[model samples]
Target: MIKEITCISCPNGCEMSVEVVENKIIRVENNKCERGISFANEEIFNPQRMLCSTVKTSDPKNLRLPVRTDKVIPKNKIFEAMKCINNIVINKNIQMGEKIIENLLGLGVSIIASQSLKINSNNV
Candidate 1:
């Protein structure tokens, strides 16, 4: 089987084609660098993606705060991670880079606040 993929490891976005037989890569083409080969293999065998989304915050001024995983998570677990993200409400004054969810789903990745949220004066 032959598969085509676009490398996202860099801005170049090298388009690559791979020839596979019985779940093994036989050849690769259209790669500009060694990273392209690695990207294709990982994409085909174990795809991963970084998660980024907004979560509810306690502050009225900023009812929602942006969050993201510190590292890439498995593609399959993205929806599950989203579920965890959606269920949480940040009741604390969260600083940028604060951990929202540590070791999310035991995948060794933490969901962190992408932006800071300060407590509303009215709430104090």
Candidate 2:
């Protein structure tokens, strides 16, 4: 079977055709660089993606805080990760890059604050 994919490892965004047989990559074609090969392999066998979303916050001024995984998590786990992220409520002001959840889903990736959020003084 031929699988078509666009490589995201670099700015080239090379569109490639990957031939797979029995779920194994047999060949990769039309890639601009070696990274495309790697991308194809990882995407075909064990795809991953960085998770970014918003979490609920106690401050009405900042009702939602942007958050993201420190590193890529399995693509298959995004919905599960979102479930865990959805259950979290940030009650205190958090700095950008601060850890929101440690070892999320035991995947060794922490969900971190993507932006600094402060409580509104009027709400205090």
Candidate 3:
């Protein structure tokens, strides 16, 4: 089967066509750069997309925080990964790069604070 795509890795958005059999890319076409080729190969085999979502916090005033992996996890493990992130409850006065969940779902990914959050000490 042939799969076609418009590459989004750069501004050029090169139109690409790739051949796949049993989910493995055998041929790639129309890409003018290395990034497009890499993206096409990954898109066909071991396809992984990013996940971005909000996580709950222990502080009422700071109810949610944005979290994501620095790299993409396996596609099938996304939900399990999400579960790990969902259960996290960050405390007040958290700072950026603070670990929120460790080895999330055994995916070797961690959810962390992208920004600092401060909460009322008494309520939180």
Candidate 4:
């Protein structure tokens, strides 16, 4: 079997091809670094996503903001993970790179604000 992927680990986005036998990767090509190799193996085995979406906040004027996790969660738990993210309200002044939820939903990934949300007086 053969699989193709664009490596997201680097800006090059090297177009890589993997040769698999019996569901196992036997060879890889077009990868200039280890990152590409790792990415390909993960994709060929357990594909995951670094979800990027907005969550509704408690503030009325600024009700929604972008958020993401420090690590990618299991693809099988995408819906469940989104549910957990959706239920959260970041009222607290989230700092840049602050860890909002540690190991969210036990996926071993922490949910965090992609951009800091400040506590402004506008929120009444």
- The best candidate by lDDT is 2
Local accuracy of candidate 3 as per-residue lDDT tens digits, 1-124? 9998888788899999998898677878899988888988766666786667778888887789887676677778888888777777777677877777767677777777777888778986
The per-residue C-alpha lDDT of model 3 at residue 91 equals 72
Clashing pairs in 4: none
Please give, for residues 8-120, the per-residue lDDT of candidate 1 as tens digits: 99999998999999999889899999998889889999999999999997777788899999999999999999999999998888899999999999999999999888878
Q: Which candidate model has the greater lDDT, 1 or 4?
A: 1
* Per-residue lDDT of candidate 2, residues 1-124 (tens digit): 9999999998889999999999888899999888898999999999999999999998988899999999999999999999999999998889999999999999999999999999886775
Reference-based lDDT, each prediction: 0.92, 0.95, 0.78, 0.81
Q: In model 1, which range of ten residues has the least summed lDDT?
A: 115-124
Comparison by TM-score, 1 against 2, better one = 2
Clashes of 1: 0
Q: If both were scored by lDDT, which would come out higher, candidate 1 or candidate 2?
A: 2
Query: What range of 10 consecutive residues in model 3 has the weakest lDDT sum?
Result: 42-51
Writing each residue's lDDT as its tens digit, candidate 4 over 1-124 gives 8888898887898999999999888889999998888899888789898877777777777787788888887788889888887887877677666777788887788877888877675774
| 1 or 3, greater by lDDT | 1
Q: How well does each candidate superpose onto the true structure, as a TM-score?
A: 0.94, 0.96, 0.81, 0.78
Can you tell me which runs of candidate 4 are displaced by over 4 Å? 119-123
Ranking of all candidate structures by their TM-score, best first = 2, 1, 3, 4
What TM-score would you give candidate 2 relative to the actual structure?
A: 0.96
